[model samples]
Target: MLTCAFLLIVQQAGNASANTRNGRFIVTITNNDQPAHASLPGPDTLAPPREATFAEGRLAAAQTGAHSYVSPADSAVRQQIEELGSANTRKRVAEQDPPQSIVDTCRNDPRADGGKGHVFHRLWWCQEHGFTARATDTNGNLLGEASVNYVAIAWGSYTSRDILVELQKTTLGKPTGVFSDPDAVRFIIGANCADTGTGNGCAVHYPTVNKTLTEWGNDQEWHNWLITSDESKSTSPDLVLRHRWNLSASVEVPGGTGGPFPSPTPYHLIRCDSATYFAGRPKACINDEVLPYITYEINSAPAISVHDVAVHIREAQDTPDLTFPPSPTPKRIPGKYIYENPKDNGLRRIPEADEGPNRAVVRQACDQLRPIPSDEQCDEYPFASTMEGAASPDWDFSAKAVNGRENTRAGGYLRWYVFWDRMLYRDMDSYYVNIID
Candidate 1:
């Protein structure tokens, strides 16, 4: 039974290699809401735009005479408003308009909404997350309000390891609440890197010129903000937003250092906060709202290799359990095989036959299922080319007996994969393997 299974497994493995579609990557977006509305004042404030009640409140407030006011001729606008109750003159305060929508549909592709365009469908890999603050008086009447939408957009290049990134902020529209001075309420945006290896760095490059919220909001251009990474050291570039939200009106970068490990790929974690205050009374500001964590990989590498390469181990044909000892462990779970070299300072190069620590483990596992026929080889689930191979300290793996010729062909396919997909060194890259029929 075992000999017949090995023959079938090797033949199917060969067929799989011939029709392989190697390099494909999937991105995941997570909404972090741990830091939102921590400091905003009042109980009857407008909900954040990302919430359902926010739109309802906007329509309700608009009907309640929450109209935009123009600064009157008098310099003491506050005093004039105080003298003429809010119901009378309608306090004159300046609120900024929402950031203009991007013109480049190529970058900011319109997502198909319930068959209609929705506000949340602006960025391809980004979800709008931010703060909504409303300043109210002792009587709880709405004074001033502002909504800040922080969007971190990143796209990895298919040809290189570099990533293209930009920061997007929008009020969504004019504020329903009014404020005193236009500049009294301020917001600054910035970024910081986290978990990058020592000596490795990530930085955001953009113009130094200061612009008003209107100017910043109106400029929806691409490649305007660039995020560059240092290749000297390898790490999983994570972005963490600290409490100091006093950055300039432009979007920003993040950094801390560490060795590389298993992760999706290069990505950004965007967050927003408005705990800042200007010289104003009846003030309110949101503490923070960590936006969606955007992660993606450019799997395509041109003629040298197939893009987004993934390994597929067919269960019925691969016969994972048909070893000499007849073990029943399932070994082809998708994405379990991570190509890495943790024993070698986080490098990603596959180790040679005698170089890796896994050789001992592979020998031991194969020895346990000994008395093998000369025509078959000890086949491992992670292929001895990944971090979780037979020699892994975790000892969380399986090995099977497969035909020598078929296993050799599969090895050839993996060798070609490394060249075709431009698999980078370190956990900076990753690929998934699926167990199919």
Candidate 2:
């Protein structure tokens, strides 16, 4: 899933039709509430594509007959409506649904540069409302009533450590009967990031304000909020741990009729450390990002051409027909290096004198070419630092007789590439070696 998601981002990064260089937040409100009456049309009456339904029997008691203004049945229904509304609001606020694809949301976002290589973030949340009101005639006669349901959603899009929050509402139902109260119901949607004792601090640029649900059948426009934090100053910040942070979005009804819904039960909407952000945007964190990789140019590092040649030949065409010199295989050589102590099995960082188990294998492959010069050494493909080294039992590797000094220089370059690329341990990460002439 992480690999596919990252690949999607890479693909989107190349699309030319993207309109904005900054991310955007889209919020929507949906109403599925309906009047409580057997004679009234049901959800099937709604236009095509809407699958929502009202709480069938939730307001049945009120529909039987209207009672005194302070009747127990009326009060119970109101309380039930409030409870359901709060619970639904909590569930929606805790959930997340990205408005668009990753790169489209990030690169096109206003916060991110209209170019590649910058980090962007996005989050989505929804809040539900179960509303009820007493139905009465102009002469104060009792009449059947219904409990109405509504949903509000908030989407937060950000880039380079800044958060942009936006809220929207959609009406799924139209209330027809006259209700006692006609005032608009207001809601508040916002976000927060708690300190985990880490020096990294977070702040909201402005306070989130309450927007009205506006009458019975009306729609709500998007509201906005912003949060900002420090970005790493390093040129290559993928491996640097500048600030560790987690952000949670929220939705609430001010008068306690709805909710103070926080993040989901155990998850934050989004969490990003500099490493995962710059390396590649993960679903939400470092653990979920695609594996790291390194690219080596054979032309630039000519001293290691022998090592490249070995790999090229190893992955070369198995049989040659009309071709004079067989062409190297088009497929890339994929392998991973291991540096962890226990997992290396004495193969990593093989010594110059003994060559360890790696030397024994390489000697068997290159013994025929030896005795040429003392300055030369037997070189092996998939270096001793890799799990697919000459000593590895699971994989077949190649060995070639090459200049010893040049081989040593190649080894130094490999070390620098590993450190600079932040390659992780075997299994945790895998990389492809793209041999470019």
Top candidate, metric lDDT: 2
Write down the lDDT that model 1 would get.
0.31
Give all candidates' CA lDDT scores.
Answer: 0.31, 0.33
lDDT of 1 at 300: 23
Runs in model 1 lying further than 4 Å from the true structure:
1-32, 35-125, 130-133, 138-140, 148-151, 156-164, 168-171, 179-188, 193-204, 207-210, 223-322, 325-349, 353-379, 387-432
Q: Against the true structure, what is each candidate's TM-score?
A: 0.39, 0.35
Q: How close is candidate 1 to the true structure, as a TM-score?
A: 0.39
- Ten consecutive residues with minimal summed lDDT in candidate 1? 1-10
Q: Give the per-residue lDDT of model 1 (tens digit) for 1-437.
A: 00000000001111112221321111111112222222321122211213122223223222332211211122353243232221110111111211233323322543311111112210112223343334333343444444344443333222222333344553433543332233333334443233223233445555433333455456553223433444333322221111111111221101101101111111222221111111121111111111111111123223222112212233312444543334355433222221221112211335454336666666777888778789777776554676655555543445666656556655665553343223322242333342211
Give candidate 2's error at residue 198 in angstroms.
Answer: 21
